[model samples]
Target chain A: MLNIGQHISQEYNDELEDLRNQVLSMGGLVEQQFSDASNALLNGTINIAQRVTELDYQVNAMEVAIDEGCAQIIAKRQPTAIDLRNIFTVIKVVTDLERMGDESEKIAKFASELSADTNSMGFYKNLKHMTFIAKKMLTDALDCYARLDAKKALEVSNMDAEIDAEFEILNRLLSTYLLEDTKNIESILKVTWCARSIERVGDHAKNICEYIVYVVYGKDIRHVIDGKLQDDK
Target chain B: MNNNKVELDQQLSETVGKPLINGTPKITCRDVNVFYNQDSQAIFDVNVDLAKNQILAMIGPSGCGKSTLLRCLNRMNDTIDGCSITGKISLDGEDIYSNDIDPVLLRAKVGMVFQKPNPFPKSIYDNVAYGPRLHGIATNNSELDDVVEESLIKAGLWKETKDRLNKPGTGLSGGQQQRLCIARTIAVRPDVILMDEPTSALDPIATATIEELMHELKSSYTIAVVTHSMQQAARISDRCSYFHLGRLVEVNDTNIVFTNPEHELTENYITGRFG
Candidate 1:
């Protein structure tokens, strides 16, 4: 008889736990990539940039692994309610983290190219600041997911505004630098592109935070109607 | 999943001997089984709870034990040789297995309808009046007439069969005969009605009528039906149980069990796997 309280096997639970661990490992790797790329930009190191580029493949593989794991769980376990939510969250988080990994690699590539130039661009300082904050936001988003903390996720969303403001400042500073020294336009353009890439990373971090909110609160905050977080209270 | 299984086992153990209050089941097993004779047991332990006035469905492949388990509700399996029951099944604080209890009287409280329309091969009115007359629910012919008309009306076939009360029940079409059978079951005024593949022999229109009738009947009587069609179970049941290989794989709210089953066996069966 299939009673509500009947004993399920340990093998099934272990499999689910293993999948959860795999997703968390993937999240950790993507967060590490984000940090490595930012550190490369800060230190102007080609080796760290090269490492970030190489890790993108691992992130891609993890994405495929997480997708396959979720499919197997849905096929074999027939999870419901909270269990369903957990598998779905893993799927979505892996996708967002993969995109974040891609953006980080782009940042690393931009850093490697800019390392060859000796120009002491003032905008690099602002880029460093942006990268630092963006990396922190990404890290905190991952932490929120690991702890399943909804409040920390909301804090990460608020941090996105600071990254956006930094991007706007970087844009204005680059325009000013271009007009003052037209000969340095190529270098300034690289800086602008890197800034845009960092801005995109910030957006993805916000998306991760939103996903964390979903995991913790079971609410979809994306495309919030009327510019308000739905009244979850 | 292992932890959940242990917790669920604990919950099931805790529920043992808890009586159903006021005909409301804390848990109802329709066609539950315990077999000691077969190489592979044919009947499964099927658990279904008809909460007060709600409808529950037992659906799965042929030989999945949907019908065998349904028959266990009123100790219908006592008639079958070599069948043993170990599970504690109760109705309103009274264990049906108590020594003082009678299977025939228990069946009166929990009536059953079969897949093929078995109308006792009697007249239309007689078929409707059979159960009440046998149980002595009415004292006179006039009281019997009231019981028959009320049962037919409750079965939604009174207007169609009113003028033909004297006609043989076998003369009606397949749909009308099934309704007559339903009216007979209703005449007993059972607290819960057990239906085993109630529409498998009927046409589509007849099936639709029966399904609609079930919705109306559930307002007053708890119902547990076993069907081969997953769609029919999803359509008419508030809750559903999926059985496989003499074991209940899963049971839950119909929407979740159908759309997102929690057991591998249930998902495989629902998605047309090995059934």
Candidate 2:
């Protein structure tokens, strides 16, 4: 739970709790943005696409605010040990969240471009499946961080491989489509860009999961092979 | 409830570091214990090495034995009636408890600054000159004047108090007064300086000045500061030792102690999870 009560000074406890709540709120906002952008892309509605782009500014603003909060806590409270790790994790996690929001906005813009042609909507089945898996990975990543659950974070981290494989399929399909059809090249390229954006979002989600593992176990799990991390003491 | 509290107290009392060894220790303490009236114990088996020309801050809650342990460095606890200290403490490889070693002379080499700014009600110049007068550090009038000015300069107070050398030491500001005391300590050219919450009374700006002075001072004098201010300890000290219930809980590099403490008791104390 990352509970930090019982401090001699309760206000310090309150400030730490408030910082965590702010990060969770930002994560929650990015999570909603991910869902809305997915819906906007599949539906190819201009209104929803516009909403997705506009909402990104909020995510960006939250990142700045949360970053400032972390700085203030470090300067004022001088958190140590697990509290320091938790604050450091929040700083790293928010960067990933903002990047995820950026990808979602990019996907929405692609959806807006494709929506102009009714036939292009049929191509969304693969994108739909990809977004579904990516969103699930992101959800699990956020949940594990909220709980500081290393086990769940590892699970979310493993799911990134599936998204990576799907993205390979995406890259293949996009190249093949371009080879088969010259007239629809511009619109097909938008689809390819959208797929790449969503795949990058999956990578960022995986990065967040890695940070969660570090926070929980004090071990850097990034760039590791076969789920192995040297347990740093 | 009683049993649970006892268990929790036992957990918190579990000492972590064993025969702490690091950089060339200026003052080495081994298995030191303090007791009042032979029954009321104030400290447990504690061992720490205060590295040469470095600052080691000892921190914990109120009555956590941080101050008691700091006092052991200069044997300040010996003055208290019924207070007894056991175990070995050496300075520069020489046993401080040796029969030939005088406690009065030992204090000159190991000076101390108290929680409050205690400037003797004498002239500012005399306040700084008192140590050298007693220790005979300066041979002549010119040498004493040089000593007074140098010590005040090192304390970061010479510029402010130079013109007003004859003013009552108590007339200076709280921060200036603390610096004056520090100057007095340095006049004797002490090898080690023990500070007991040296800046708790000063304003933030003043506290900052003393903290900065500590950095400059560590180039010559080893400092062991007992502070309730955690942030100050993190900012100024080279190493940190967390003490709780008379037991030495942990000692490590200041950065490591602040970011990745080893003991559960140390963790709980620094993280403010302690009661």
Candidate 3:
């Protein structure tokens, strides 16, 4: 005979797994869009930019589906404690991914504009560096989710600082280029916008890492002290 | 003057029958069942222990056997011709179903207030004194007056009706009349009190007043109530039993039932999935 308590727990666990899978799928699409937009800027390819734009639609659709799935589970199961945290976190994570998709489209537009300029190599290299860090943070955050590893989530959160630093460097370097040579000002401005988009991607990745902490420990560490993360006891 | 005095003396004797049964459970039910007839089973094999000095709330959906089970607790099901029960139910652990236990006395211990406030069309003092006089909880003119005053005070209706005890109980608002019924029940000093959807008929403010009264009454007497309101159950009950399809789904501490329900059916119901 199946005990009712165990049956309910199993149902809740299954719903959590479904939600986790949806989040991973959404994360995968956002990461791919980030990579494609960066490569388009680096290689001066309009075709890559168009491909990234097309992939944004898929990410948007996945966001809606994941949101509906989370709502259904909450209405049907009424999960509590850790399960409730996981459901709420999935809703927030998917919203962040959807915004990341919008940012990726913005990066793709910047790449298309940069493709038309003569001196694009210097701008491309800076964008590539920013994309590399943002992608790494996103990948690590998703890995933390897959393994349910709070430590890896913390590492991902810490790496966001490096991505922010890269964004600052890109900002200064692009402004210097624009001031020194006004001839290709439009191209430089486009590259700066692309760098800003990548910085936002890093921010979204940091948000996901925060959500992972909430899922594992059931704590809302968002505006609180940083050292509290280590004080899980 | 001679005829009126003779009539008053006769009425007084009918009011006080015998000495009150002291310190005993008003009603006790064990392994009770209620069926629509011989075939349609409503309440399953059930055993309940209702002691004096506590409030128990039975909560579930429309056909979850809560009302049927409440009716059985007070032997109100006896009025239903075909509804029968099995196993032993005792008042103070004495088998109530045995020939020795009178149905009239069983009802005196287990008085009920229903979902809707159904006060009799009589004066407030008359309403409070009706049950005690019938059961002889108090004897003589002065003693019945004291019982009525004390019962209304305990029901929290004395302050509102003390000067107007002679006014009709039905004239009071829905909340007050329900309290009047509670006063009537308390006047008999029953070992247990059965409430069946007592507040469903009242508004939110009235419901709050009744819930507050229930909290106060729990320390002195055992109370068994049936309610369809899940929030009311969560708010007032120390313990709760969830029923579904004539079977008891789960019984646990009130907080556990509301926040961390163990059964999927209970969880689904609480979250508004399927009732």
Q: Give the TM-score, chain B only, in order for the candidates.
A: 0.87, 0.93, 0.87
Screening candidate 1 with a backbone cut-off below 3 angstroms (N, C-alpha, C), the clashing residue pairs are: A5-B8, A5-B9, A8-B5, B31-B69, B31-B70
Residue B83, candidate 2: Cα error in Å is 1.5
Candidate 3, position A94, lDDT: 89
Best by TM-score: 2
Highest DockQ scorer? 2
Candidate 1 regions exceeding 4 Å error are A1-233, B1-33, B36-49
Per-residue lDDT value at B193 in model 2:
96
Worst 10 residues of 2 chain B by lDDT: B1-10
Model 1, docking class:
incorrect
lDDT of 3: 0.76
Q: B209-236, model 1: which lDDT tens digit per residue? A: 9999999999989888999887788889
DockQ for each numbered candidate: 0.05, 0.45, 0.04
Ranking by lDDT: 2, 1, 3
Residue-wise C-alpha lDDT for candidate 3, range B1-275, written one tens digit per residue? 11101122232111111112235544455556678889999977665555467566687778878888877766788899888887677767777678777888888887889988888899999998998889887879899999998888889899999999889989999999999999999888877788999998999998999999999988877788888877788788876777777866666666766654545555556545433
Better of 2 and 3 by TM-score: 2
C-alpha TM-score for every candidate: 0.56, 0.88, 0.56
